[model samples]
Target: MARLLDLRQLDLEQIDAVHGRGTSWLYPLAAAMSGATAGIVISGGQLATATSAGAAAAPSGAAIAGAFVSDAALVLGLASRSVGHISLLYGYDPEEPAEKLFILSVVNAGTAASASAKTAALSDISRLTQSLVRGKTWEVLDRSVISQVSKQFSKAFGKRLTKQGLGKVVPAVGVLVGFTLNWTTLESIVDVADVEYRRRFLIEKYPHLANEEIPETFSDDLSDDADEAISVLNELAEAGGPDLR
Candidate 1:
């Protein structure tokens, strides 16, 4: 089975960084840069310089440095969008650490909302009263969580790289595979991050509405029929038997 990474496992530094850049223009800039750097990471600046299988060997020196920079920007861009989306749904104060912690807790709880749920909650804050941070406290990000997340990322990338086997030796095919994996992974991360953040933001902002009872809605026709049936049964019981004419 492929190992999965939990957004909650992200350290406080990363969380804070995203919060800080939630509304900055840098995210759009990074998206533009990634379009170019992504190719560099796959071809290692030697796309056509070598045709042998060995040309696609593990990166070293400049290639390693290039890949590192490119990937970091990609991840930052992804995080920025996630935080920005939350901000759009429920305003956040970058200056508030408690709010950030609540966001982290929501990520930990993995409380994702569907499109209909999101629309309903956005329409009415009271509908999003469930709290993920209630009765929960967190002081620091655990090292084990970080380690587990790292392992999951490594395993995912390893599987992708190894799956192509000899085909990856071709720079063209490698670029296609690398780009596809990156795009798919980004989409998955965005889906989880967006939904969870929206969920937490609503609950945190509407704490007063927490635990509010929701009245169940039933069909009026069914209710009337049930009431009439019960009334008839009561009359019969009161008379000790059904009257027969």
Candidate 2:
């Protein structure tokens, strides 16, 4: 199965700040992701410190994320391209264990940017001095397409879409369409097979989710065709197989 590892907010070292957005965004995101995979453990490395008299430095998750990225490269091991982006790990916790939750906002924003900014961004990074730069590809998405699939999946799953909670729920809903898979349905509905729906689903489903009120500025971006397709697939699965759907 295609796994979307959640390392969104795990960067404790903040090393990527040195590289700027382009590739920097990649190191922290990918490293924590790879580390979360099977058998991957943190090295607890020390970060570079200011040039001063031997001042001891504390280890960081940022170091972990960075080391993990390096290790994956050293092993000459790459995830199957068919796996697509291999999940985008993000978020960085301030405390220990560094609650490195994946920041879904970036992905949600990234999908839109792919249409409006992808070409220029890629061109700028590649230094490909050319005028024919195309690929403002996100224009292909339509509201109906997004709403249709969104509603379809909602009906199938029979779950209510409310506010942005926090932790798991926040990240899960935001990144539902990040990759190509059935995560939407997988996360949307909870099995009613148990009593105490609140305990089994809401309160316990993802206990870390914040109780913050839904942002007044909320949006359901179904304008991206890629997002829409993934949404439909997730709904189908959540609704149940042919026996259920």
Candidate 3:
């Protein structure tokens, strides 16, 4: 008998598009393997080149630089708090600090920018929303079938995904995550759609990380400290790798 292979074909470009220009497999990859934030730190420039076998996308140096800026905005916007080995105090400003990060100590949301804000929070995510809105007629893209699927496909695949069909899925994920995230990033999961894919997979595979048992902090929570949420991701490659998975 022959074994069936669940082959998923993903392109470097598609991956980069979904994860945004400068996404990396580290944080998302770390979140999948380790946690959202991990004991990982690299230069703003190095992030664009880093990617793991698990990566669904790969990025370029330009994208890596984009990630740095994006993540910085998220950290300050979402105001994330301490999770895993990564603290909310970290933020990379290559232009200012030469890639050295500073922790935000206290995390807050509605009041002041601290270390608790997450991507789900409207304010936190909005930090990037305007720029994106101006760049494209988002209204038009939002109507595309790709965007449609991005909004609907929640956690249906895994790191063991095919890079092929994502032409539709990735954009959908991007549009949905990008759009919904702007409202309140932490309102849902990090990869709100991808996590759903893993959550369902975990329930079937390990059956240990239960819906209620899994640490809620790792799953979903908003923060006034949006910056904390954006720190680690600011410098990653926006291409194929475990990060997007």
Best by TM-score: 1
Candidate maximizing lDDT: 1
What's the C-alpha lDDT at position 21 in model 1? 36
Alpha-carbon TM-score of each model against the true structure: 0.39, 0.18, 0.19
Which regions in candidate 3 have their CA more than 4 angstroms from the true location?
Answer: 1-116, 119-200, 206-209, 216-245
For model 3, the local distance difference test gives: 0.26
- Sort by TM-score, best first: 1, 3, 2
Of 1 and 3, which scores higher on lDDT? 1
lDDT ranking from best candidate downward = 1, 3, 2
Positional deviation of residue 57's Cα in model 2 after best superposition, in angstroms: 71
Per-residue lDDT over 50-141 for candidate 2, one digit per residue giving the tens place of the 0 to 100 score: 33322354334564344434433321122111011222212222121101001111122222212332232222212211110122222223
In model 1, which range of ten residues has the least summed lDDT? 224-233
Candidate lDDT values, in order: 0.38, 0.24, 0.26
Residue-level lDDT tens digits of model 3 in 1-245: 12111111233244334443112223333222211111011121233234433233333445533433443344333322221112111111212211111112112122122334333232222222222223323222222432233222211111101111122123214333333323332222233323332333334334344424443233332243333322221221121111211
The TM-score measured for candidate 2 stands at: 0.18
